[model samples]
Target: MPSLTHMALVELEKAGILKFVISQNVNGLHLRSIYQGRLAELHGHSFMETCPSCGIEYFCDFEVETIGLKETSRRCSDEKCGARLRDTVFDWEDALPPKEMDPAEKHCKQADIVLCLGTRFQA
Candidate 1:
């Protein structure tokens, strides 16, 4: 599912050169990529929603409309607990999602090499 460049990264990981990927992109491209399992979405995903009551992630094919961690129009599929599903897309006002942040922080500390895509990320 990865593009040529992303597949190149997958190759690195396959070779044990790339340990982890920390991404702030909401495009959901990474999720569709072959390296999806090895990456994290730091800013939440435009096509994902999470159940607050039960920690389950729903990855949808369609792009979620709302930002700022607002509740989406859908409900959790779990019948016993039909909780409102919150869109994972985050805004500047919200804090970084912990599910993504914790691993990113851990990898940043452990990795000997860090690649900055563009903007400088201050720890």
Candidate 2:
């Protein structure tokens, strides 16, 4: 699902020219674009979840059915912990996850130049 531009950035990330990606897009195209980590989804992803109890990450092949950090029908499959899984999407009132924000802030501060791609922001 990665566009050509996204793939080009993937190459930059591989060459170490790009350090990290902070994305608000929830389409999961970046994840599919040979993204070998070093990224954050500020708005959460439709195909990813993290277990609160065991801290396990699950990436699904299909789009998760719900959004807004709501409980999904699935549960963690771990033998030790089978806690119900929650959707990763943030509702309008939801705050960005610190786990993603902290590293994004750190990387941005350390960068000499930043290349922001197709995105929109409001003051």
Candidate 3:
């Protein structure tokens, strides 16, 4: 999402209609441009890439070109491994992060209204 979507989410949160937004995106647009500590970005934020080995999430303040296209995907900033972090959001094989799931569950359990937008479910 972009700045507009981020603001809408923030407003929804303030209205208490939404506890958090679990995005299947790694853009980090919300985490960087919008309010922090209020979102549960499931796919991980782009501002920092975590090392699967060391579990170290490094913050890179350097400016990366926001090309707004597929070319935006690049290798991690760490020169050591230079591993290209996956930006396709949460992989099909990957499971949900505990930190993200907790809040989602809490919201679902307590929310008087469950709004499923544009979801396609199979019976």
Candidate 4:
């Protein structure tokens, strides 16, 4: 992703031109790093960490390794912490994160212009 593109999009959102971002990507770049408001990850994000024991969801500030897995898989570097970073919408055995879903729905319902670009809707 281009930094200029990110800056441009952020500016658009801040200026109330683009209200929401619904993405099939799990990179976490758009939401976690770039646009901080009104985002819905239809896929999920790599920067979010989940606790398997407590189901605690939090934005992480750790690096990840994606050298071997599929293009989407990401894990936190804190082995002692034992929290795994999820890039997908979570496992079928798991549940959806409200932090990501609630605002997405709200944006969808409120936004006047809905733009779909380069999206393949399988869901």
Best-performing candidate as measured by lDDT: 2
lDDT value, candidate 1, whole model = 0.81
TM-scores, all models, native as reference: 0.85, 0.89, 0.55, 0.57
Candidate 2 ranges with C-alpha deviation above 4 Å:
34-36
Report the lDDT tens digits of candidate 1 across residue range 1-123.
Answer: 456866776678778898888888787776665356568788888988989888689988888878888888999989888999998888987888787888888888998998786457776
RMSD of each: 2.3, 1.6, 5.9, 5.5
Per-model clash counts, in order, read 0, 0, 0, 0
Best by TM-score: 2
**By descending TM-score, how would the candidates be arranged?**
2, 1, 4, 3
Residue by residue across 1-120, what tens digits does model 2's lDDT show?
688889888889778798888888887888887464688888999998868788888999989999998888988999889999988889889998998899889988999998878865
Which residue pairs does candidate 4 place in steric collision?
A: none
Cα lDDT listed for each candidate: 0.81, 0.85, 0.57, 0.59
> TM-score of predicted model 3?
0.55
Error of 4 at 72 (Å): 14
Better of 2 and 3 by TM-score: 2
Error of 4 at 32 (Å): 5.5
- Model 3 agreement with the true structure over 1-123: per-residue lDDT tens digits: 366766776678778676655565666766754466656666555556454433445555643333221223456566676654432245546787787878777766776876554336332
Pull out the clashing pairs in model 3. Answer: none
| Distance from true location, Cα of 106 in model 4, Å | 1.7
Query: Model 4 TM-score?
Result: 0.57
